[model samples]
Target chain A: MEDNGRTARKRAQILEAARPVFLRNGYVGASMDEVAALASVSKQTVYKHFTDKEQLFTSIIMDTTAQVEGLTKMITATLDDDGDLARDLRALARGFLGAIMEPELLRLRRLVMAEAERFPDLGRTWYERGFERSLKTLAAAFGRLGERGVLRLDDPELAAEHFVGLLLWIPVNKAMFRGGNDLYAEADLDRLAEAAAGAFLRAYASPDTA
Target chain B: MEDNGRTARKRAQILEAARPVFLRNGYVGASMDEVAALASVSKQTVYKHFTDKEQLFTSIIMDTTAQVEGLTKMITATLDDDGDLARDLRALARGFLGAIMEPELLRLRRLVMAEAERFPDLGRTWYERGFERSLKTLAAAFGRLGERGVLRLDDPELAAEHFVGLLLWIPVNKAMFRGGNDLYAEADLDRLAEAAAGAFLRAYASPDTA
Candidate 1:
């Protein structure tokens, strides 16, 4: 049992170190030697945890899907608030912007996309597990809102897509192309969240609900 | 006059050859020697037209911005039609989707974004000249529609952003991550365009306009 615990701890340490190395140098450019050095572990130990560089890169991306669990909870909690719908939506959007705009997340996103062509399965898995999971949760919340007569939409899933599209398209694209997250001021993000929520309500809100 | 014509012709030849080379190998991996060999021009001729690899890449990107002029014209022509507003908007959306979905253009977009960190100025120039120019034209078209009482919006630019966001957020991101443009069928694109136009009209169309 003690040996197993030590093995698990070493594996965790390798994963933690691999994230930054992958983020800094991308998949093709990152080296296993660097990861081993950064983790302060023997190179043999690093390979023991991850069979190869591709395995390590895949492991790191898969690990990030866990981060979205927090976002799922936030979406469910914020959208379920008893406050005004607009305020609730604004808060949700703010939460989303805040979560995605983390510098580490942004760099990871760029790295994933940069390598998407080379590693198609990694990109698809990340999209399905991390991106679509959040959308599905949001869609369920929107469906509940629709059923309660708070919103009027034929398709809650489509509405969910539009909600995120409106909020994320500009800033996310800017970040992707500019290679940084400092492009938007806090004031800018607030205005964007409000604009997206406002537009969403205009399109989907029931007259009585407003 | 003959010498100027020869210089212009050589420049065009070099650009035509450089596009494929850059697409196959990203900025860091692309080579000037390959460009010269592919252009059927001597290295001296290639250098005569472009100062360095960076200059060559920038010129390739800058040259593509002219393609947006075609989009601007299409927007004005399509939206200014005497046909039904919904039909016109759908057609415009369809055109927008078709234009951006070209395989070469998608590859170029990935290349620009991939190198964005290393070539901040090139990315900024591409965004301002190609991306923003199209959005500005769309905004102006939306403003004219507003003035004509067809659409109702206090901010045309925001409406334009929403229009594109609704239409493009899914497919563009998918392409960016999947590294292919075949993810969406033609029928899928038609459905997406119609949905976007439907949502935009719901949010911004004048009540009497419909």
Candidate 2:
């Protein structure tokens, strides 16, 4: 029974170790041996848990889908609470920045970007898990904004895409891509989120709307 | 005289061949021998023309810079023409779309983005040359918009960033990043450009301040 418990724990450890290796090495550069070594598991054990690199990486990203979930759920509820628009947006931005800034998530994004050329499937998965889902959550927020009459938007979905598009370059420059200016400090984050939300409201808010 | 002419011609060929090779292999993945072979020049001649790989890439990007110049120059002149904001902005968006669609430039952008992780200098150069310069041009256009009193003013630079930021993601995903979207045909360019411009103008134009 103790040995069975140990095996279960070992399987989880291997999966966790595989995440960084795949992120750091990408698809082509990464190897199973390195992941096993990192996990302190035998080669056969890795095979038992994951049939292939793609499977392992896909599971890695999906399992960590929890990372973005907290921010999404938090913002959706907060955006509904009728807090000030600028304040709400800044809070939302902090959540987003905090989530992406985690060393693990940052590495995951880098790995997806690096391997995007050869194994575009990984990039698509990352986009689906990260951007697509986030956009849906954001659209829900916009829907609330519409209901509040703070903005009259014909299509919250397109508006959400436009809003999130502004931030795509932000992460690309600051973290994964490197050599982008320093990551945002607290004040910088506050300023950018406010400016962005303000501009978005100004542009999208129907004249008679919010 | 014959040898000198042949050498100059060979140098041009090497640069030309380099675009395709660099696009496919990435900066580090590319090799001089392959470039020499593709150019139909001796390795010695390739070396004679470029001191090293970095110089070679810089030269290729410099060549690409010329391609970006004419479009913006035309837009700036058109924007300055009695502040014809509509025509000017339409032309600018079309120009941007046209620039974004060019196959070679698109490939160069992807190559730079992919290789940027390992080579931070390339990312800086790309941002300075491609992103910053383009922003400056847009700011000037917005300055003209303000001069015409069609728009209210804060920071023209930030306004310009927002303007371009709106359309930046689509082509980047389609052409450069290969995120699996069909490229827009030439016929739809102006229409697509105009819609985005109109949406932008609505948010931006100071209550029909014109």
Candidate 3:
């Protein structure tokens, strides 16, 4: 490995700084000067690595997937590890919900969503890096679960989408509308995990009929 | 009966004028001058009716609801008359989906959701007028269906939430990020509606093993 840890660290700092500016000002409104000031880096340093604002945003989103890719590896690895499926699913839900709710992450999403009319490619990139990567992790987990005779599912991908949809939608949508900040607390998360897991079992689990 | 027809029409005109400007310039950025100019009314005329920007916006939103409320009533009434549950649901879904995708409505929604962080009351107004009202309609329909023995449900409210969640989440979220210009065509709408209704039944229909 080429010890580029310092460079990685700087890049992380820049990305973190850029996120709020992009969120507050949206894509077309945000300026490099504000991002540089927030990151405490010189404008020359900011441009040295990224070619443009789009490229900088593209990098920040890629960072999101890098994180997803790591967790995905472990989620797949644990499919046969004797972990409770509900626990595993809950952990995955927690991860997904947490990712979607990060203030910077939420703002990043809003910025793309808000600017999507004028900037389709930004939304496309964010979706490709964020949601698609998470879907793959869930799909892999479902495939492994089916193979282990724990469940029967014809389309693992759709099942994954449904499961993840439960994890997100309500809390995330409410947050998008400014209604769920206090609602997603610890008990709320537990309720979400239970509701999602129970409903999932009701639809897919073999007739234990419990 | 107080017709108030001209007053209603003038209010409608004001809302139509206000919605686009608010979408383009955001809540704080938009000015009454632009709203008045767009409405073809004098700035004095604008102020004569609504006292301030907040009240003006609230009245515009309420008036918009009074107008757009007809779509839901039309859909629900048509479904109430006669049709298979699944077919009726599909038709309602198509109508509902189409209405939301209207360019002007989509833009308005984004403006409300975007500025929801700063002015929370606007977001609450949106939920009260839009999402909550929609959810309540679904619950009422399902409640009637349950009583008629066409369906079985303990909580139609959650079921309604789930149904709305599925239909609205993907396309609406996509629109939130990408604008609603190229949503499903007729054939796509049919397929989506059928799929949604089918998936919903698979989970909620009464136990047939009896």
Best by lDDT: 1
Each model's lDDT comes to: 0.88, 0.69, 0.69
Off by over 4 Å in 2: A1-11, A61-64, A97-107, A167-177, A180-183, A208-210, B1-8, B174-192, B208-210
Q: Which 10 consecutive residues of model 1 chain B have the lowest summed lDDT?
A: B173-182
Local accuracy of candidate 3 as per-residue lDDT tens digits, A14-78? 99998777767666678999999999999988998788998897677566656667657666765
Residues B107-157, model 3: lDDT tens digits: 777776766666677777776777678668778877777776676677787
Cα misplacement distance, residue B116 of candidate 1 (Å): 1.4
Candidate 3 Cα errors over 4 Å, as ranges: A1-8, A25-31, A50-58, A74-91, A143-154, A206-210, B1-8, B28-34, B51-56, B71-83, B147-150
Checking candidate 1 for backbone clashes, the offending pairs are none
Q: After superposition, which runs of candidate 1 have C-alpha atoms over 4 Å from their true positions?
A: none
> Candidate 2, clashing residue pairs?
A149-A210, A150-A210
* Model 1: lDDT of residue A192: 91
Which model scores highest in DockQ?
Answer: 1
TM-score of chain A of each: 0.96, 0.83, 0.83
State the lDDT at B22 in candidate 2: 79
Q: Score the docking of each candidate (DockQ).
A: 0.69, 0.40, 0.42
lDDT for position B7 in model 1:
88
Give the alpha carbon lDDT tens digit for every residue of A1-210 in model 1: 999999989988999988988887667678899999999999998988889999999988888899999999999998887669999999999999888877888778888877877888888889989988999999999998999999999998889999988889888887877865579889999999999999889888998986
Instruction: Please give the ranking of all candidate structures by DockQ, highest first, separated by commas.
Output: 1, 3, 2
Question: What number of clashing residue pairs does each candidate have, in the order they appear?
Answer: 0, 2, 1
